[model samples]
Target: MAKGAAKGPTVASLKKVTPENLASLGVERLAELLVSVAETRPDLKRRLRMELAANQGPEHLAAEIDKRLGSLQTSRGHVVWRQKPAFVRDLDALRRLIAERLTELDPAAALDRLWLFLQTAQPVARRFRDRDRDGAVAAAYVRAAADLGRLLADQDPHLAANALIDAVAADPEPWAVWAPETLRESSAAMAAVALKAARGRLGGAAPSLAVVRALAQAAGDLDALRGSWSLQALANPSVAAALAPQFLAAGRVGEAGEILRAAAPQPTGPSGRLPPPDFAWESAWIDYLDQAGETAAAQDVRWASFERTLDVDRARSFTTRLADFDDVEAEGRAFAYAAAHTDFERGLGFLMAWPALAEAARMIAARPDDLDIDPAQAELWAAQLRRRFPAAAHRLLRAAAAAAFRRREFKLCDRLTEEADTIIL
Candidate 1:
């Protein structure tokens, strides 16, 4: 055996304990051993119960599940983060039990059970109050519901669509409303499956506008999909954006554009001041423009969006589009515009990504002395500069080291000092 290896029963030794041996251990001893095992591995107990339930009919298994679910203390009120493990395990176990039971029922029957599980599970999952974990639990139930929806769709799409529509249209309880994004995504996936099935059944006939509206309504909010559109739908750009692709795919390009445009940030809201522009909606609109064969309009949108946000990736994308156009003059003009108007950090990134190293160095040198820059970012720029602009690299590193020392960041100061010395050498 290797050093520090644990000594315990080997596989061969454990294999000696057969069912016969277990049976021979009198009921009391066996029960004690089972309790000990269950105490050590709670999952084993759940599995054991599920295994026992497997032999019974679906009704028995469901009853067992309900009993377990009922026993869970979901109303413990403001669970400490430290106690999340027990709650997570309980919910996960219930989810597994529900999934296992789902496998035994026919599609329609399974859908009913899944719907019930979702209705019950939503409030229970929300009890955690932690957004991330709550979302995760909600996502798990959504996945379960989606899986059932797919199964039903495979058997009978119309039936699946109806069931899914009804589930989504059902008003959410107060607690269930907290995790709307998860619910929306899961419901949307099911709706997509339903729509695909319905389309296939229709066999090339355009789905009636009513059918489209019904599917969209299943996503819980239908203002964007209603026959009459609403500006308030823009408040949830994701919802509006989600509907746009469906419209675009259906060749309703004008309607899609309307949806996106309405969702764009207006100068004023009912309360007076409009909220910030939703980048998601803006990006979606740019995509729509490109798809509509309005290349110049798309480019304008991209540049305008980038200017408004200074989003680095957006800037890079605009520059890439210019490069693709083979317009070197345009690219240079864009770079000059960015350097003059954009923040130094964003401009530096844009120029570096453009591999306009010379321009980047000039920009770094020209930045005002009192302007704050992240030390880590400065180090990165310094390293990049070292390859082509040694003097600039050395200056950046010295400044970074001095700043680190002033901030009492001795380790970073030492590292920067060493790097500066290497540049000098």
Candidate 2:
């Protein structure tokens, strides 16, 4: 008398069938099946087209690319929100195809076409309402530029240098902010190639210094690489931060340290609030110090930064260093300090993430009776603690439920009351 399970196989189960069986059908039936499958799965059709295009020569592929590009261009007037992603995907596929063909046959032509694609497609991307799609198109353009730069780097270094320079100079405001990490990385790669070409041209007595100067000139800054617009476009912390590794690589560790120290943010005002530290620059300095066997200095910076900010990540990192040096007492103190000063939920998370459960329990128990904690979060934490420390969990839930009741958070109070009862039972 039980109700029957849903009839028919799921699409996932249907996918388990072998393609060999489908091939056994006559050509007419196979064609019919292909139509059905293509209707159901558009991505399959796209993949098949890409595979066919890959097998064709550059001339044929170029024609196909033109056709796809034309379709996208002409469809701009009538594009709906739902159809925008499809159009962007089609354009991306065509651009990639064009780049591949042109790179293989003519690197110079590839660079020209990619530059044109960036100019044309970026406007179209900007028009789309979906920010993610715009970012995707932007990333594709940057990647294509990188590919073109690599292609032209060896064949015609000047052209490659110009192409890369043009790419970095392109306006990257909204897209860069939306997708800074990837866009910054792609821009950096292009800049690196341009710098390499400049270095090749400016071989001198002090090759490293000359190369840095040449990089400055190529960036259109006659002064030096420091504070160049081109270097700013690369989104590194500062010119000194960017150049430190290059100096270190050239066996100038002392110069690298000087550069980093000069760039380091100074403490400000009587409150001793330092300027918001550039994490990347700080990390680089710490790494360089560690590499130079200045373990104590590195640890000192790490601990000071953590104490000033109560930043959980810095605390963890400092703890890791302490553990490496077999300093368990310092590590425990670090965790205790973080737990004491950090916000209740964040402190709980930091302690739990560190798997310092005993410390977490102690911190919760020691919290002032009048202090407010989010009732829902307290209940959740109590649930997590019940498995390991039942007594502490029960006390926490009861306290949170009382706080919730006092605040007229009846729903949370009821939930916590039930949870506390369950734990006690």
Give per-model TM-scores.
0.65, 0.67
lDDT over C-alpha atoms for residue 407 of model 1: 96
Off by over 4 Å in 1: 1-36, 55-60, 72-81, 100-112, 122-136, 154-214, 217-245, 260-278, 291-293, 304-325, 353-355, 366-371, 383-392, 405-415, 422-425
Best candidate per lDDT, number? 1
Model 2 CA RMSD to the hidden true structure, in angstroms: 7.9
Looking at candidate 1, what is the lDDT of residue 299?
Answer: 86
* Model 1 alpha-carbon miss at residue 94, Å: 2.9
Q: What TM-score does structure 1 among the candidates reach?
A: 0.65
Question: How far off is residue 91 in model 2, in Å?
Answer: 2.4
Candidate 2 yields a Cα-based lDDT of 0.62
Residue 179, candidate 1: how far off, in angstroms? 11
- lDDT to native, each model: 0.63, 0.62
Model 2 spans with C-alpha error above 4 angstroms: 1-28, 33-57, 71-78, 99-116, 126-134, 146-156, 162-193, 196-251, 267-281, 291-294, 316-326, 339-347, 368-371, 375-380, 399-409
Model 1 lDDT, full chain set: 0.63
lDDT of 1 by residue, 31-134 (tens): 88887898877666876776577577666666666666555434545556776666566666666566555455534444555556666664565556675445
